[model samples]
Target: MIALLSALLQGCALPSLEGRSESHALKRAETADTALGRALMPQAQARPGLSGILPLADARDAFAARVLLVRAAERTLDVQYYIWREDITGNLLLDALSEAAERGVRVRLLLDDNGVSMDAKLLALDRHPAIEVRLFNPFSVRRPKALGYLTHFSRANRRMHNKALIADGQAAIMGGRNVGDEYFGATDGVLFADLDVLATGAVLPELSADFDRYWASASAYPIDRIVAPEGTAPAPVPHAEDDPRAARYLQALRESRFVADLLAGGHLPQWARVDMVSDDPRKGLGLAEKEDLLTHQLQQVLARPPVASLDLVSPYFVPTAAGVDVFSRLAARGVRVRILTNALEATDVSAVHSGYARYRKDLLRAGVELHEMRRGAQPQGGGAGVFGSSGSSLHAKTFAIDGQRVFVGSMNFDPRSAHLNTELGFIIDSPVLAQAVTQAFDRDIPASAYEVKLDEGGGLVWTERRDGQTLRHKREPGSTLVRSVWIGLLSVLPIEWLL
Candidate 1:
C-alpha cells in the first residue's frame, strides 16, 4: 500500500525548470552610485583587501539592520533563508521588500521549500514585477506536504540551510537567523539565542556570488512554477505601533545605532581577513563532491588544532561518535574543549537532544566539558548578549578556537549539518571577536547555563549557580521524569545520522 501511494505521488512530480531565466547578482560597479554603495565605498577603499565585520548579537538590531538595508537599497536585494515565518516581523520585512520593489529595486527572495508554506501572500509577492520568489527543492503536493517526504525521501531529506541578506551588492548580513517573531524576540514563547554579522567590503562580492549560485541552481523553482496564482496580496500588517508586542521592537529600532553608525562610518567594524564557507548548492540534489561540502572547507580553514581552548555553541548538538572521538583526542592533548547546547527543558527539539544525550557519558569520560543552557535564564545586556531572553533556547551556531579564530553561521555541530543540509558561515581571523566569544564562555555562559559533570560514583550531575550559591541536580535540570524516560528510549534508537 505504501509503495502504491509513493508511486501515485511520484506520478505528479514537480514542474520542469527548462526555461527558467537565469539571473546574476548586480556587480559592485553597477551599484556604486546607489546610496548604500556610495556610503560604503569610502570604508571599502580604506580597508582595501580586508572585510569589515559588525556583530549583530542583539535581536532587535539584527532585524533592524535587514529592514533598514531594504529601505536603503536602490539597485538590488538578494535574500535567502532556510525559514521565513509569517509573523509580525516576517510580514513587516515582506512589506519592506514590497516597498523596495515599488521604488524599482529588483528583489530576489530564495527560500527553502521545506521551511515555508506556499500561500496566497507569497504568490502575491511573486506577482510583483520587481520581485521574484523561488523555492529550493519544493514539494509537488502542496497540501499534505509531508507526503513529498514519503514519496521522495532521498530528495526531500536534503535541504538548503543557508541564510543571507545582501543589499546593493555592497553589504551583506549572514549568519544563523531566520525571519520570525521568535528569532527577533517579539514572541513570549521560546526565543532563540542567535547570532549574525553585518559584513561589507571584500566579503560582499563573494557573498553575493554565492547567492547567485543558489539562485540559479537546478533545485531552485520559481514560486509561480510550483504554486498557481491565488488571491491578491493581502493588506500589509499594521505598523508596529498597532501591535503591543511589536511596539517594543519599534522602540528598539529607534534606539539602535547600527544603521546610522554604519552610514556615518562610526560603526567601527572590525577589519579582518574573513572567508565565507558554504556547501555547494548542488548538495541539495545529492550531487556535490565531498570536497565541495562546507565540512571539508571548515576542516581546511581550522586545520591547526587548538593549543589552548575551544568554545563551541550549537542548539542542536548531536555530536556523533566520530565527533566525540575528535573532541576526546583534543581534550587528551591538553586542549580545553567546552561545549554549550540546549538543555532538555530549553530545547525545542527533544529528539535531537536524545542524540546528544546518548553520547554525554563518553564526552565526560574523555574530559570534555559540557554546558546546557537553562530555560528562563536571563542573559546579560537585557537579553541582547550572546545568550537570549528570560525564557529561551540556545539556537546560535558558533565557536571560537584558542581565542584567535571565530566561526559564525548556520552550520551546527551535528550529523544533519555535516551530511544532509547545505550550510553557510564565515571563518574570521579576528582575535577580538574570537575572544569575545571565549570571554562569554568564561563569564556569561556559567551564569546562564548548567555545567554537566560526573559525580564521585561516575554518575552524571548538573551544577547550577544561583543567588550566590551553588545548587546540584542528580538528573537533567528542569526536565520531567517522563520526558527523561522518553529521551532515554529515543537515545537507544540508531538514528543519530538523521539528527
Candidate 2:
C-alpha cells in the first residue's frame, strides 16, 4: 500500500513548459476596426494620450459591464482572475464567454489554480477550439491538493492576484473583483463591496500587454497539462429565471445604462492620464527585482507625500510596523489619513483582522483616523452601491491621495500584496474621482462604520452612530469575546507576513 501511494504521488508531478506555444495579444491596428474599437476610438482620438475611465462602483453595473464587453468583442477576449466560482454569476459569465467563442471570438481564460476547483468543467471548456483555459501555479496532486503544498510550498504559496478582462485589445475592465456571486452582489451571503472600472483608449493596450505577460508566464499551465481529459464539457448552467436573486440581477442588467451609453457614445468618462501599475509576473517565482515590484513602482509614481488628505479603503488592511510608521509620519505632517477597513464581525477572513487589529491603537495615537465597517451595512437606498449591500463586507481596495489623485485596483495595503502575490491597479490624475472617495469618507462612511479612537486612558474605544443615537462599546462591537480572544492570540503570532 505504501509503495502504491508513493508511486501515485510521484505520478502527480507537473509537466514541463518546454515547447509551449507562445501567443501574444492582438495589436491595436488588428482590432481598430472591431465594434468596441469603433465605438470608443473617436473619444479616444480626441483625448490623444488620456484614457477614458468609467468607475463601476455599483455591483450590478460592474457585472453588466463585463457581460456587455464580452458580448461586444469581435476579435478576441482575454480574461484573467484569481477566483471564478461555479455559482450563478460565475456560470453566467462562463456561458457568455462560451457564447462569444461560438461566434469565433478567441477566448483565453487564465485563472489562479488555488482559487478554483472545477477541474471537470474547466477541462471541458478547454476542449472548445475557440476557448483556451490555463491555470496559474497549479497544484500537482489533483485530489488532496494539500499534498502539493507540502511538496512545493514555496511555489504554491505565491499567487497571481491580478484581475482583468480585455476585449479585442480595445477595451478593458480592471479592479479588485473576481468572478463570483459575492463580488457581484448576487448572493444573500457575504457580498463584497468591490470596485472595477471600464477603461478605453490608451490604457487598453497596456492592460492587454499585462494579461499577455501573465498568460505566457512560466506559472501558467494549460488546463490539459494539469487536469486529465474529461468527457465532453457539461451543459452550461442555464439562467435561473425562477430564482428571485437571478430575477433581481436580471432587472439590474436592464436598468444599467453603462454599456448602452458607451456603445451609443452618450457616456463620457473622465479622460485623464491613467498609469497602469502591476507587479512583474516574475514575482510569482520570487525572481522579480525590487525595483520591478509594484510597490516600488507605486512609490515612484506617487512620489510626493500627501499634502492634505489620504483616504484609503482596503478590505484587508494589515499595516505592519513599517506601514504604521508611514501612516504615523503622514499624520504628524498634517495629512488627514483616514482608513476604512472591515471590522472583525464583518471581515471574511478573521485572521486578516488580527493583523490589522494589533496596530489600531498605534494608528489612532498618531492622529490617523480609523473606521471599521459594520457587518451587514447596506448602502443607502438599499441598493448595491460602492460600499456594498446587505450582509456586505468591504472588499474594495482603493485610496485617494491629496484630493487630487486616486487609485483603483487589486493591490491591497497589506504585507501579502507587498511581497507575496502579484498585484495590478491604475493611478489616475483625476480630482473628480479622488474627491468622490473623500466625499464618501465625509458622508456615507461615518454612517456605516465604527469610529476607532484612543480614549483618555490610551486604550481603544469604538463609537457607533446609529438611528440618531451614539453608542459606545468597550470591546469590538458585534464580535464575541471568544473570537476577540482568538484574534488577540493570533496577533501575537509571527504570521503578519502571510496575512
Point to the candidate with the largest lDDT.
1
lDDT of candidate 2 over 242-325, digit per residue (tens):
567667777878876866876676766889999999999888889999998999999999988899999999999999999999
Count backbone clashes in candidate 2: 0
| Candidate 1 runs further than 4 Å off | 1-7, 231-248, 257-264, 380-383, 388-391
TM-scores of all predicted structures = 0.95, 0.95
lDDT value, candidate 1, whole model = 0.87
Please, what are the lDDT tens digits per residue for candidate 1 over residues 88-122?
78878888998999999999999998888636677
lDDT value, candidate 2, whole model: 0.87
- What is the lDDT of every predicted structure here? 0.87, 0.87
